[model samples]
Target chain A: MIVGERKPLDEILEMVKDAKKILIVGCKGCVTVCNAGGTKEVGILAATLRLARLKEDNPIEIDEMTLERQCDPEYIEILEERAANYDIILSMACSIGPQYISEKFPEAIVYPALNTCFMGGAQEHGVWAEFCQACGDCKIHLFGGYCPIARCSKSLLNGPCGGSADGKCEVDKEIDCVWHLIVNKLMKQGKLDQLTQVKPLKNWTTSRDGGPRKIVREDLKI
Target chain B: MKSGSNLEKLLNAGEFVITGECGPPRSADASVVREKAKYLKGYVDSVNVTDNQTSVVRMSSLAGSLILQEEGVEANMQMVCRDRNRIAIQSDVLGATALGIRNMLCLSGDHQKFGDHPEAKNVFDLDSIQLIQTVKMMRDEGKLISGQEMAEGTEPRLFIGAAVNPFADPFEYRVYRLAKKIAAGVDFVQTQCIYNMDKFKEYMKQAHDMGLTEKVHVLAGITPMKSLGMARYMQKSVPGMDVPDEIINRLKGVEKGGQSKEGINILLDQIQILKEIPGVAGVHLMAIEWEERVPEIVEAAGLLPRPTV
Candidate 1:
């Protein structure tokens, strides 16, 4: 799940103020689960835009469409014919969807309706919390399904630092110390001895520190 | 105070009221909508152009209301608080009043998960109650939510309306919520589809007891069930909808040829019962896809020529 929130209406209105023919495009992907960039969201944006334009007496034409997966070319190709009808495409899909639409329809102007936040899940109804960084590395297995890269302010790979007090992070008292959680899990599993071993320095270059990483799976390719 | 508008006159006279719902165009074409307006010109006292109804995007509700006003029909602008914040909501209300759309209905709106764009972001800046209060504040105080006075001292006057459901789960809360809205300065109320007259009568009695019968105008929302599947979906999927077991059984009793007729008849029967209720001000007919059948339903219920206040 991707955790995100909608941009303010005034900001969105400013973005597409001059667009006479606006197409509010929604995606049925990560954004849908997070209550953004879905068919319902597109309708809301369309209605709000309509009201805004009417208020200014600048009555603009609005058309709404939702795609299954906006990031996929196959899903986006379906909109090629309809793309020419609008002056601007307001994508309610995730950040990737707008980029894909721009890539596919180079001539049409594309705008993002939602602020792309982070990869996470719903903490509860109407509340979403970020839990992953997609750091191009898998260390959760060693730490019992918790990613310190996302949960910790320091992104420490080893045991709790002296800064951690009362199982809370030193940076933000509200946040729990990830290393503390890791130690508690290890102690419960009777593997506290694992903490005694000095861990090697992590290779920071393999993460986002290295610009634009790609994976070529020869076995999956046709 | 005698207003020049016929709608104002009707409201003052206390006659049986007439209200109709207009579905906004899905595209930019206004000709089709213009044609529909012609049918409702003299037939209905007021026409409600929905705002992104069911969370499906369409032509602007404000634009549609303006168009209806142009077509010589009184427009009731439906304003949903699903997408706009307090600033946009206040601005739109003032704009609608300036454009001659005096009738307004405030709604919390259906969640985006149900609409075509399920992934679109939702901005519930205010719920229906807060929206009503916002409008009242604007009308009474002539100021925005920030408590800033208008430069021109213009007051936005609206026949503010809100929605209620008699058949919603936890039935007492539904009635309590309506009371809260009325207290929040809602002048009128339009209920969800009335499928069960007995339940409606019970609800009406409670409303009367609450003294809402005199202070607020109550309109019964009547939507003619098109098919069995639609009825089933309304019962199962639509929140705050209650289709009684007897009505469902009656709908089932009809053969394939008579299903549509049976459904329409059931709606008519409900309206007939609703009209007899003492406190009901009018009927807000929502013919969804079958807008053409509204005149027939209104006529069948003996509500043609719209009673004046």
Candidate 2:
């Protein structure tokens, strides 16, 4: 899931501090899974904001709506007519949704209520950990399913550094050594011999280092 | 008994005790939380650490509770059944008790559909009523839900609590539901954010008639609205919340130039009215980002401290 977190309450309060009419928009996609921006959060934020406003006696008109997927243009279309009802839109979706709103409604101010974190998976109930960097490449097949690009502090490909000790990352004892996990997985599969083949330096051209990238299939295009 | 235990004793002594909520920071930083805690420490009897509140990922409530405890403030660890099953919930309760967290607010929780985790599977193997029963069973029977004896012959105990929204659809039914929760072993009940004191009083009268007043502690939840737009959004969007037209009109009546301060004053007024309601045990202030303003509202409500306690 696209793991993210709500921005600090004070920051969010400031973002919508001046608006007379506000709409809290929630997304039901990746952000919902990570618990950053979704319908329930939108409700709580709306309540909290109301409480804050009530305390001040400067009551504002705040409403909430949730989109099936804010990042998708199709779902965002649902917000079109409703968008004009409020002066400001407080999107509880990931960063993408707010930008999409801004793009679609140039006149209406769009504000993000969540801090987009990173691509990760649920490690356990209520725990999400970063597991993918979306480097525009996939090498998990060679590394036994763990992405060093995301988990490794240095994104090392060949093996663990000399600092790896007791099967833990030396940089932080709390962090598991991803290379060690890779080695263990490879050993279990009798693919340890692959470790002898030194891997080349990763190419940064295809990733964010080379600016925005895109993928297009002629057959899939209109 | 520890000082914390003594505090619990005071709470049980029929004093007009106050409680509030403190949502942990979304980031790894604890400085902001500490600052807010410092402001709230002596004002309220206990502070609730909301668990992934509203299904938004936050710093663990366990860690937040420990921080409050270390700072010499009583902490109420809220545990929701929406995210975990019986085993995890049981272990977490036991762990919290070991860490000196004596108060617990059990909730069935708003569905993941309501939270930021709609796609996330919910674990409602036990509802709020069942969880309360489990806690009572553990404390009284020293056994799990399966009837197996707890390890080491030790069981967790807590000042069990729950939430009720008197403004929910079929309002009277919401009050009846509270009766059920109280009957199932809820020691205290903190209501959803209350915008209308009159409505709350009416609900309290019903609760009193039902004889729930003698059994369960009732804390009225109060939050100061920040702006006019916010008030409208809350009434329209917040499920199980009712923001009366008068309050909205009063807010809208304020001059545009002085809205925020006016809103705060209005909230303070509501708190004052809530304090006077005969059946109200106390108030649960949910300031959200305005945690710094809680002391002012409490003092304004004329509830600084009990001379007898």
* Tens-place lDDT digits, model 1, residues A43-118: 9889989999999999989998899988789999998899988889999887888999999999989999999998
User: What stretches of model 1 exceed 4 Å from their correct place?
Assistant: A1-222, B1-8, B151-153
Off by over 4 Å in 2: A1-222, B1-7, B150-153, B306-309
lDDT of 2 by residue, A1-222 (tens): 788899998998888788888999999999878777888888888999998888889887789888999887888888788888887899999899999998998888899999888898898888888898888888888888999778865465644533344466644667787877887777678875565354543556677767988788999877
The stretch of ten residues in a row with the least summed lDDT in candidate 2 chain A is A157-166
Worst 10 residues of 1 chain B by lDDT: B1-10
lDDT of 1: 0.77
Local distance difference test scores for all models: 0.77, 0.77
RMSD per model, one decimal: 21.3, 23.6
TM-score of chain B of 2: 0.92
lDDT of 2: 0.77
